[model samples]
Target: MLTIIPDLPDHIFGLRASGEVTKDDLQQVLLPGLEKLSEQYKEIYYLLVLETDVRNFTAGAWVQDLIAGIKHLTEWKKMAIVTDQKAVEKFTDIFSYLSPGEAKGYKLTELPIAIGWLSHKA
Candidate 1:
């Protein structure tokens, strides 16, 4: 399941995921939400909190993720992935170099720090 992260500032687009997140979640919930958020904020400050493992996502979901990412390629500002897995964290950190904007991963314990970092303007 995917749901919006509440109580965030206008500049941030945040979501929390648990269990199995499917393509429908992205096509229906995630993509439209980003489109709306991006209309108001040129740069997308994304925060995704994963309560379940990344392996839980279906194959179609991964495709939709890529599509959603590419749809807003130039508008990315900061992406903070909140997951407990160290490998995922390291991957996000390394991939940040190839991305137009910053990307980082944090443990659930560092969620507050992640949000704070994204909240600040560069």
Candidate 2:
């Protein structure tokens, strides 16, 4: 499931994911939430925390994520992905190079630092 990460500034959009995050979660929760935030701001800071229990994404969910990302390609101002999973870390690292804004991956133990980094303005 996905839930907002609380206590962030207005321009920051954060979410914590655990368990099996399905296409419905992206459609019903994440994408719509980002869409709404996009309407409210020109640029958005994003924080995604994939807790250790998170399972693999469904095929459709991956497609949705790609679509949403392309739709808001320039909307991201900063992004931090917190996880200990190697594949996820590698993917985030690669995606970072293609992002318009700064993107970084942090170890699960560095979640606090990741939040702090995203919270700061570039």
Candidate 3:
């Protein structure tokens, strides 16, 4: 399941993912939010919180995410992922530096800090 985080300004979009995420979830929940943000802002700050309840993505879902990410690569200004998964943390730490947009990963406990950093002006 997925839920959009509330209380953020229009330019900031946040989503929390739990349990199994499928392509339909992306289509129904995330895509609409992204489209709305694209219409309202030149660039978007996206925060994704992946809790322990979030299981692995299905193959179709993973493909959709990759395509979406590539499509909006330059539209994103900042990406903050809050996850304590060791592999996820390591991957983000290693590759975020190479990404076009600023990206960072924080433990779930630091989600507020991640949100602050993503929403802050550079």
lDDT for each residue of candidate 3 in 11-118, tens digit (9 for 90 to 100): 788999888888988888888888788788867688889974445677777887887788787787888888989778777777678777887889999988997898
Instruction: Specify the poorest-scoring 10-residue window by lDDT in model 3.
Output: 52-61
- Tens-digit lDDT track of model 1 for 1-122: 89998998788889999999999988888898889978988778999998888998889899999998998999998999999988889999998999999999999999999999999966
* Most accurate candidate by TM-score: 1
- How close is every model to the real structure, measured as TM-score? 0.96, 0.90, 0.91
| Ranked candidates (TM-score, high to low) | 1, 3, 2
Cα displacement (angstroms), candidate 1, residue 59, comes to 0.8
Best by lDDT: 1
**Whole-model lDDT, model 2:** 0.84
Per-candidate Cα lDDT values, in order, are 0.90, 0.84, 0.81
Greater-TM-score candidate between 1 and 3: 1
C-alpha positional error of residue 36 in candidate 2 after TM-score superposition, expressed in Å: 2.1
lDDT of 2 by residue, 15-118 (tens): 98887878998999889778888999877788999984445678887889889888999888888889988788778888888889888888989988988898
Error of 2 at 81 (Å): 0.5
Candidate 3, residue 9: Cα displacement in angstroms equals: 2.9
Q: What CA RMSD would you report for each candidate?
A: 0.8, 1.6, 1.5
Give the Cα error of residue 52 in candidate 3, in Å.
3.9
Candidate 3: Cα lDDT at 45: 83
Kindly report the root-mean-square deviation of model 1 from the true structure over all alpha carbons.
Answer: 0.8
